[model samples]
Target: MSGIYIHVPFCKQACHYCDFHFSTSLQYVDEMTDAICTEIIMKKDRITDQVGSIYFGGGTPSILPQKSFEKIFNTLTTHFSVASDAEITIETNPDDLDAKKIAILRQLPVNRFSIGIQSFFNEDLIWMNRAHNAAEADSCIMRSQDAGFENLSIDLIYGYPLLTDEKWHSNIRKAIGLQVPHLSAYSLTVEPRTALAAAIKKGKQVPVNDEQSAAQFISLIEKSGMAGFDHYEISNFSLPGKHAVHNTNYWRGIPYLGIGPSAHGFNGNTRYLNIANNAKYMTQIAAGKLAETVEELDIYDRFNEYVMTSLRTMWGTDLSKIERDFGKEFLNDTIENSETFIRRNWLENKNGTLTLTQDGKLFADYIASELFLIDEQK
Candidate 1:
C-alpha cells in the first residue's frame, strides 16, 4: 500500500539546529493551506493504490488550525482512495498539546502523534531554542494519553555539548517511563547555514562530538533493548508490533505522495521534489501548476538507492531481490563488496540477507557507500 505525506511549513519559532524548510511567521497560513489542498487535487493521479498512511510533518503541523486539517482531509478523501484504517499521524511539539488542543485532535482522524520532545531538560531545551520547556515536555505525553491517544512516539536528541552521559540516560529513562511505544533519538549534527553551525564557527558553541554521539547511541540501544524495544532502524526504536507504518514503508521503497512546500514524493521509478519556497509553491499551485522538479531513476540510481535505504533498517538488504530487480551482475558486485565488511565483523551475510552488526551501524553510511554500484558511463 502507498502513503501520503503533508509537510506543514509553519513554526512558532525555529530550533537552532534545524535546517528544514519552514517559516517562523504565520503571515500566509490560509494561502498556504489553500495551495496545499489544490496541489493534492492536481496530483491526484500520483498514487492509484489505497493510501495506507498519511503523515503530517514539518515546521510544526500542530500549529495548524482544525479547519485547515479538515480541508486537507476532505480534499484527500475526495481525490483518492484512503484506507479506512490508514495510519494518520501528525508531528507536533510538546507545548502545543494542551487540554484544548488534544481535545481538538481527538475529534479528527489522527490516530498517532510524533511529538518532538528533543530533551527533557530545561537547560538543554533553552540551548536548542525549543518552543517548549521541560515541564511541557514531561506533561504532553500524559495529556495525550489522558485524551485517549496512545499510539505515540517522541523524539529525543543527544550528543550535543549540553547532553552529558548522565543527562542522556535520564532522557531515555524518562521516555521509557512515559510508556511511549516508539522513540526516535538522533545525534546533534551541525548543518551548514543553520544557527548551530554559525555558533560553532564564531566560537560561541562547541562542535558536536562524534565520539560522544556513538557512545550515547550505544547506551540508547542497550537501554531500549533491556526495556523490550526493538531497534528497528538506526534511529528508531519501537515495541514489538508498533513500528511506524509510514516511515517503514519509505525505507521499504513503497511509493508515497508528498504535499506542501519542501515535501518530496516518489513513485517506484521517479522522485518529485516540491519547491522549498512557500510563496512560490503557493503561487504555482494557484496557477493550476506544480512547482516541482522530477528525477527519473536509472537502474544504477535505483539499485544504489535500495542499498542505501534498506541497509539502514533491521530487515537489511536482500541479495535475491537485488538480482531479481536489477540483474545478476549487480547482485554479484554487492556480495563481492560486502566480503571485507563481513570479515571485519561489521557486516553479516546470513543466508543471502546482509545486515549491519551493532558496530557496523555506527559506520552505516561509509559501509553502504563502499557497497554502492557506480555507473561507469557517468
Candidate 2:
C-alpha cells in the first residue's frame, strides 16, 4: 500500500523535549499551506499507486484553521487518486480541539486523530511546556467522541523525571478508560539543542533515567495486553485491525509522497527530504522549483533499512523475502548474525520468520544494528 504525509510546521508553543522542526508563530501558516498544496500538485506524478492513507503530521497540524485543512484536501483530491476509504489522519494537540474546532473538523474528511496527550498530569505538562492542561487532555477525547470521531489514538511519554510508577499506571488506566483504539507511547530522550537537553546540561532539570524508562515500558506492555490491545509495534499499541495504515505502510517499505517543509518521502529506492524552513519552502514552491534533497538507495542500504524497520514490528523479519530480494548471501549473513540472539532467546526464528521476543524488544535498536549488512560483514 502507498501513502501520503503532510507536515505542518507550526505550533502554539515549543515543548521542552521536542526537537521536530516547527515555528511557534502563525505568521506563515497560510503561505505554508499554499506551498504544501503546490508541492502536491508538482509531485503528483511521483505517486504511481492509489493513496490508501494520508497523514497530517506536525509541529501541530491542529493549529491550522479548518480552511487550511479544506484547501489542502482540495489540492490532494485534485492531484491524486485517493482511496474511497483512505485512512486520513491529523496529529493534534489537546488544547486545539475545542467543541467549535471539533465541529469544524467533522465537516472535513479527517477520519482519525493522533492526539499528543503526553500526560494527564498538570506537573508533567508544565515540565514539558505543553500548551494543554490536565483538564483539556481529558476533555478533548470526549469532545472528539461526541463529534463522532471514534478512530482515535493518543500519545504518552514515560521515563521523564516527574513520572512515578504510580503516575504511569494512572496514565495507562486513563487511556484504557477513554477506550481509545490506539496508543503510541514513547520514552523521553534528551536530544541536543532542545530545552530539555540544555536544562540537563545546566542542572536546571533532571535527566531521563533509562532504568526507569524500561520498567515503565514493560508496565505499558503488560497493562495494554491485559486490556486486549496488540503490542503491534515497539512504541504503538492498538486493538485488532486498528493499526495505523499510514505508519504500517511506512514500516512495510511501501512508497509514499511527503508534502510540506521538513517532510520526508520514499518511493521504493529513492528517499527525499523537503527544505525545513517555511519561508524558503514557500519561495521555492511559488517559483516552481523543488526544495528538497534526494538519495538513491544501494542494495546494502535497502537490506539494512528493511532489517532496521522490520525488527521493530510484531510481524518479524522475513528470511525468504531477504533471499528473494537481496540474494541468498544476504539471507545467510542475516541468519549468521541472528544466531547469538536466537540462542539468548531474544530473537526467535521459526520457519524463516525472525521476530524479537518480549525480552529482546528492550534492546531492539542494538539487536537490529548487529544484524546490519555492514561493508566488512557483507
Candidate 3:
C-alpha cells in the first residue's frame, strides 16, 4: 500500500524564511484545483497500490476555497482506493482555522490536523511574516479540539535570531502542555531567494548561528525526552503510538503519489516531480502532459538515500536491513566509514544497528555524507 499527497500551493502570504513553491496570488486557485483533479485521474493507472493515507500539505492547505477542498476530496474518493481507516492529514495554518471552519473540516474524512505554529510569539511570527498571530496559535488548537478533532500536530520553528534558549524551552512546553500527540519542530534556515535571506543581505536580519541552532536543538531533545515523546525523526517528536504513519512510511521507502504543482512522486525505481510553476503546470496537465521530470534511482543512489534518511531517525541504520537490501559490500563499507565517529563516541554500533549518540545528531548530515556511496564520475 502507498499514500497520496496533494499539494495546495496557495498561501495567504509567504513566510520570510520559507522557500517552498507557493504563490500569494489567488487568480489560479480554481484552475489549479481542476488541474490537480485531472492529474489525479491521469495518474491513477500509474499508481497500482492502495492508498493507506491521503495528505493535504502545502502552502497552507487550509486556505483552499471551501468548494475547492470539496472538489479535491470528492475527486480523490472517486479515483483512489483509499482505506476506510486511513490516516487523512491536512496541513493548516492557525489563522485559517475558526470554529465554523473547523466544524466543516470535521465533517470531512480528515482525521488529523497539522497546524503550522512556527512560533507562539507574535513578534517572531511578524518577523517571519506569518499570517497568524500568537493568540491564533493557542485558539486554533483548542477550537479544533472543541470541534472534536483529537489527532493534532503542531509545527514549531526554533533557532531563529530572536528565539532565545529559554524561549525555545517555553515553546516546547506549550505543545507538551497542550497534550498534542505530535510535534514537528524545525531549526530555522534562511533558504536562498527568500525574504529572510534578503533581510540578512540588507543587514536588517541577523544571520543564523550554527552554535545557537545546535544548542536550541539540544534543548528540544532534552525537553521532548522529559515529556515522554520520542524524538522519532530529526525534527519530529511524538508520544507512543503518535508517530505519523504517513511520514514513517515515506522514511521506510514506501511509494507515494504527489499531485499538484511542484509535487513529487516515488514509484518503484523512478522519482518524478511536477513543474513548480502554477500556470505552466495547469496548462500542461490540461493538455494531457503530466509536466514532470523523472529520474531513475540506481544502487548508489538508493544506498545513499537510505543512509541519509535512516541516520536522521532514532532507528538509525539497520545493518541487517542494509545487508538485505544493498548487499554485504555496502554494509561493510558503511561500518568501515563509521569507525572514526565511533572512536570519537559520536556513533555507536550495538546489536547490529549503528545509532547516533545525542551529541552525534548535532552533525547528522555531515556524518551521513561521509558514509555516502557517491559513485565515481563516469
Best by lDDT: 1
Model 2: per-residue Cα lDDT over 68-185, one tens digit each: 9999999999988999999999999999999988999899989999999999999999989999999999999999998899999999999999999999999999999999999999
Whole-model Cα lDDT per candidate? 0.95, 0.94, 0.89
Full-model lDDT, candidate 3: 0.89
lDDT tens readout by residue for model 3, 1-378: 899989989999888899999999889888988999999999988767678998899888998877888888899888888888899999999998998788788778889999999888999899889899999999998888888888999999988899998888888889888889899998898898998999899999899998999999998899899989999988889999989988987787889998998999887588889899998999899899998999999988888888888888888899999899989999889989999999988899988888889899888888999989866784
Off by over 4 Å in 2: 376-378
> In candidate 3, what residue range of length 10 has the lowest lDDT sum?
44-53
**Roughly what TM-score does model 3 have, to 2 decimal places?**
0.98
Ranking by lDDT: 1, 2, 3
Off by over 4 Å in 3: none
Q: Would you estimate the TM-scores of all the predictions?
A: 0.99, 0.99, 0.98
Candidate 1: worst 10 consecutive residues by lDDT? 40-49
- The true-versus-predicted C-alpha distance at residue 316 of model 3, in Å, is 1.7
Report the C-alpha displacement of residue 6, candidate 2, in angstroms: 0.2
Query: What digit string (tens of lDDT, one per residue) describes model 1 on residues 1-104?
Result: 99999999999998999999999999998999999999998999888889999999999999999999899989999999989999999999999999999988
Clashing pairs in 1: none
